[model samples]
Target: MFSIKSLHKIIFAISFTALFVVWQWYFVKSVFNFDFLARPILADGFCKDCNVILISLDNLRAKSLLCYGYEKNTAPNLCSFAGKSYLFKNVYTPSSKTQDSHFSIFTGLYPISHGMTVPFTSVLDSNIKTLPQILASNGYTTLFSGPKNDPHLPLDRGFERGFSYKDKGDEPRYWMDNMKKNNLLNRKFFAFLHTYRVHEPYIPQKENINKFYPGGPLIYVTRNDLCKKAYIKLLSQYPDRFKNLKVLNDDYCNIYRDYNTKYAATWNVEIESYLARLDPYWDAFNNLDFLVKKEYTHALYATSIYEMDLELKKFFNELENNKLLDKTIVVITADHGEEFFEHGGHSHAANLYNESIQVPLIIYIPKSKSQIVEKLASSVDIMPTILSILGIEAPEKITGIDLFSSKENKFVLAQHVTANLETIITLKWKLILNGDEKELFDLTSDPEEQIDLSIKNTNISNDLENKLNNYLFRLPKYNSIKSEPFPTWIDEEQRKKLIETGYF
Candidate 1:
């Protein structure tokens, strides 16, 4: 009993619905390759079927790892795995921070090129091609696991879009559970695991509490308690300098909030006084002597690494049990290194010293020759190397080179936005330039970067400065939106968190 016009309208609606479904299915099939979704692809441009796993350790200095010549057994499991891996001894990251360094890793571009040099409110361009994006296009199921509360890392950026299964924590069980739920055992897969255990306010499990701090002067109380006491005392002295400051509790430490007034000299003065009070506790390591309470902090840092190593061992054992280790390519590296008053700085993202920029790069490929490569490498190289190994051609505009390529990288760059800093590292020399200040170190003689050779070696300083300037100019500028300006201000939640964790 419907009218002729109404019947025609219903027919049109049904036709439109059918067309939409067909288009959607076609899109999915083209993008995901539903026909051959389960097939695995080898890294040698063949179809032998292999899996790729990228594990990023946060705030882990190469000097702290036993594999990297540290006296401590912080990364024993990693050391054991390095026996069958290709270890790159001189690997550096593009940025001395987590957000930008990881971006440089996922994208084969430096921090300046990607326009994500700063964190909190920074957004990745939708058009940018990420590692997961490339892998997903090639019939690989992409997964991600990182810090639960770091919004700058996951959803705000486009990284989460390329991942099919992503968890909020760095623990391997979360990734394993997701993989199992998706039935990804036999399917091609790429997993990115990010762990921040070795980062600031280092608090480890109860069992590992006394492992490094046994009978130490500050072993009776938590490092966070002492740090908070100092910070509260400073706050009481200079309340005006700490305006808009708030406090947040991380899992390991009590983070003092950040503020716009953090740049004021008065605030720094009070903080310096507090640091002076705590210097004795930080001078436990005499080799790398600096005036800061590093013993308590470093002990906790080592314990965290030990805990993470235990989890890593467990993950490796699980893979072995499942017989998946033989077919998987495992990459282990860090976003950036930590500092223990190495250059009068306690944490990272403020300086570009070796202790802040140098990281450990261990690549383990199944049935491959294990050799230690001393060639210069950067975080940017990770993307190209991954793509090259996976039988995929890198993007045309990629700046990073393949790690296994015959050609050697002559120089690598690292940047930090706090001081508008730029650093250039060559085989023999390293130049760190901040505004009008320049510091040149002869790496061959001064590995610790303790000697400043800028005044004595003007020729070397000028040459490196020119190279850094030219390199930066070659990269793209920050241009997120044409209509709206780039967002430099961070939100309150992220700002507070960053400040608490010494990001500011």
Candidate 2:
């Protein structure tokens, strides 16, 4: 009953549907051959079949780990695993904050070069050369799953998958949850994991706190009550240091929160409201730290660290189980580090001190089994090294060095943003330059960065300043590197995350 044209149309529709099914089945996850989907095919044929996994722990300072120094067993499992890995003694983040630090991380350039200064509206460009792109361009599968700037899965960036916060969640719980949802809890490939539990108001539950502070009930006793007579009864039994009720008050005003007619200065951008806390402002942070420490027995802190430890055990086991362990490269580091009043700063985005810029870095080179390098290195170096190891030619524009393959690290760079242009760190010395003035520290003599030798070591200070000037001058300008603008529908959740982590 059908006309000739109608019959012809029906035949064409059936053929197209049949072709679509076959295309998906043969080309997608069902037959995910890395050479075609993610990475751009390349010549020289030296392909790294190695599964690359990069882990970034947020607000984690290197010194807190037993693997680094710290008397407390903060990262016992990490320490245990350090025996079989190459632990770098000193690794620096390029900036005191996450945006700038991560910029250096993703692009291999300094903030002075990459230009993502303020957290308000800064974004990393698409054209910027990132690690995932480099790996993907050389017949390797790439999965980028973090901040928006992460070099993966934007449909345009060539990631096999992109778990950017825009399309997915960014909480630490979401990371684990998503892994389970995707049935990737055990699947091994080039994966990057970022954690943020140690960040601010230090909100660890009281139960977790009890593990650390054994003397008290671990309850949030009001500051008013702590400064009153009743609690002082218990205090009187203790030493003179705890004698005066007012002494325990630890009261102070934070003007950073206050705005008045007396000051003529106006903010170009909205300043963050001052975060006020009780007398023991660090109660939350301590509890979280306890949770981190509890892994030895109760295993809260140790539990989280060791949870990753066991997850890693399963992870590595899966790799071995899947015949992929021998062919993998793993690098562990932090985006930015935490602050525990080392420099009178409770969190980051304050200054460029060791607590803010220094992070732990471990490179478990495949087959090498065990090695440690003491060279001063930057997070930016990881990308170049991976490219070099794979024998894939990295774009020459990168600012970082291949720490293992090259001996060129006489000095490195670190940055922070304010119109002041006040923050900087170098190999032997760390300095903060505000306009014409400077604050200097000799990191070699004082690793904790307590002693500021600006007046005493004026000569050395000047020398380092000159070195910084010449180096920065020679380095590429942030504006010079052209990059594709971020999407028009910008993700503000990422902005909120920056504020939450104190990047404001």
Candidate 3:
């Protein structure tokens, strides 16, 4: 006989044991199934010809889009023009930051394999075969225009041409100069433009800022940018040696407690930045809608997509005025999305929550018609889909499936790395494997990712964990050994900038 508490404990112990056994059994079975990560033979690869213009909006959230059920009409140009585009309900990037996510986007490989898993890490391994590199070989005159952070320059990511992307206005101009010169060639090849409109500082002009921040879901974006500017300005004055900050966000909380102290003054100047005025509410969900109306929303990105949109609209009007809308495959996507206190986070990189990882994938299908698909796609698949669309054989080394061909989840994989280790996400669930602990979430039931389903669904979670661990193990090792140093995605120029700014 047992007391009530003891009886419950005994039952729990038995349940735990049973779950462990079931998980072990399923873990082996799933890992052995090679069809999960299959190489797709796309028939579309052999039957298409169109001008491809791939544009990625940085840090733009899917839920923010009007097409995806949000209340606001954020992307009117896209919603109205694109006919056969598939807006994948769940498309997650491997990592949340620009460096690793875009590296994965370009290579169809995981961050772990490419060694771009951490921030400020230098250029991706030059030898790694990338999407643009493969596309260039297939007669595409690959041209890209965006912010300096686009590819970190140098190796140029194999694209034939690269532009100097900056945070100042004129994002539209970045591509126009090239567009006018290559307008003829563009009719024959693909031109890519990636924009970063939603990265921090949501930096728009005073008039522009009022439209989104004076009562909205984007208030956080504007306020956060204001704080960052203030902080960065103060950090700029520090010695390079002390400025090398290891912590992702600031860690000097207690230092400013006593504001009257000399030490506090230094930090106060950093923290207490002043602007003319702040908007009513900066986090409005209708921020993009307001932007679309004003036309400066694209300029707020520091690179020009609105201008690009105007150019595109003008080009299309002229084309339809002459007849060429059917000949272009226009796509709009995001590397990752900005976090406006969604998970008590600021930038992408620290964690892999849905708001930060979920990106919009809309392609205004060329000549044909675009329709939204209810399938879950990964950013990795975008490159292969592009290759297939243009009738090109995807390179042998790539691991993405042609999404248009395979509408099912044979298991879409996503990974991310912070200071310690990496995490992996799948369709059914997400398994985060840090050194000593494992976090599991059943994404279907819990989209917010609030519950740790690992213990509750040990059998399924453990199986997912094994696959994630094994997948990470396959990434390229820097040293000849199994483990080496932590990842640093910053380039030499960026490193110098960091050093000068006292950010190690």
Candidate 4:
């Protein structure tokens, strides 16, 4: 009755229609029942006397940790802790930047809601209720200890409220010293420790460097500080060679401005003219990528992770020796994850990819058995989760749900305000909307986000977009007064110092 080609075409059309209908039905059912799919409460609440110890490791990714299936012993101590703590398998940061992610964690609000997204300009509003302020009001002394020299993290930004001791260092000795000197261990306290050692310029000790890169090239054997020095000298000598090289401006010094002041002064040429005359040829300077892409880079990053783990191990041992571990809740997480050529770029604040937003969240509460929480969670959930664990009611303004609740939400939202990117990720799908461009990934099939199914799966894409918009609509307008912007702009003098430190 019909030609063979026509019959085949008819069959294909019917099959496609059936698949589309089935997919739409499945998507709707999953979105509605996602939270209930695996709704198991992992941990119990803590007593009122329990103290809190929060640790933030910068640029640490969930996949980098051995507990998360990394083959390397990058974080042995963390792995041990993970076995004894509630390891959140699907936790993400609200934003992929350091300052903005921390703001979301402390304030229990999204970046836009808190009015702190940019590092140089965004400041935490004083009117916003922060975790430390609330804990201090409830008779818990707050303490902050991290690098004292970073200009980006000043105490005036409302994060330092109720902080009795704010010191600097990546090591735990200084913090322990202060705790003993201030009689903090005897009191109910909330200590927040941030470490940048695991961040860029991965300057692990020589032992760690050698351990990771044994018998490797000396160029790769050097720590980040040394590598930075060499890279800086090389760039400084041939400033014209790297004029068009793509770089994160915040991570590096303004070399063009520096060269103009010093070299142009000697050459008697205008800075603008000198910069304009430099021919753009990044391909010729292929060594730049080579240096960063070498095995040494991976080794250095791994070594840093190991070194951070050792520090935490020592800190935890000290706490355990003092019997503090039995009475305190320890929360270890990161602001964001680093990327190594993932999605064609490195470091963070570039995309909403899993490599950039997914962070390790390990929470150890006293007298609680460890279990992995597979539900979707974000940085904003930390504040509310901590409050709930302490048996305190979260503020009405808090948008995050209790991660321990069986009724945890179906989806988690992550954003990058700088790139104008927003994402809505469920257990099965991730949809990223960047202006007019859209990318959809099926996490079950493509966890690497290598494929874009937006065009092929238009129904799923539209559904996720609608969900994202609905969630965004619930956010109250941010009305907090913004703080004065701090000066992080580089000048001629600042440029020289930044270069020596291997910045940029």
- The model with the greatest TM-score is 4
| Candidate that beats the other on TM-score, 2 or 4, i.e. the better one | 4
lDDT agreement with native, every candidate:
0.74, 0.56, 0.55, 0.73
Residue 469 displacement in candidate 2 (angstroms): 1.4
> Which runs in model 3 stand beyond 4 Å of their true positions?
1-42, 118-121, 148-170, 183-187, 205-324, 474-504
For model 1, where is the 10-residue window of minimal lDDT? 251-260
Which tens-of-lDDT digit does each residue in 1-504 have in candidate 1?
999999999999999999999998889777965534343222334323468889988888888888888888887888899878889899898878777788889988887887765444467776678999888898999877776446447454555768887777666546676666666777899988887767655657756757776754343345655556656665686688555655764421233424323443222342343352344333334444343256666777888889888888888888888887788888999989988766766777478899889999999888787888888889899988887777788888878987765545789998886458889999899999989999999998999999999999999999999999998888765454322343333346534445433344
**Candidate 4, superposed: residue stretches over 4 Å from native:** 1-45, 149-151, 221-295, 480-504
Model 3 earns a TM-score of: 0.66
State the local distance difference test value for candidate 1. 0.74
Per-residue lDDT tens digits of candidate 2, residues 355-402? 777899987656665766678788888777666656667767788876
TM-scores vs. true structure, each candidate: 0.75, 0.65, 0.66, 0.76
lDDT of 3: 0.55
Ranking under lDDT, best-scoring first? Answer: 1, 4, 2, 3
lDDT of the structure predicted as candidate 2: 0.56
Q: What RMSD value applies to candidate 2?
A: 20.0
Residue pairs with backbone atoms closer than 3 Å in model 1 (clashes): 282-292, 282-293, 282-294
Candidate order by TM-score, highest to lowest? 4, 1, 3, 2
54-81 in candidate 3: lDDT tens per residue?
7776777776666766565555665566
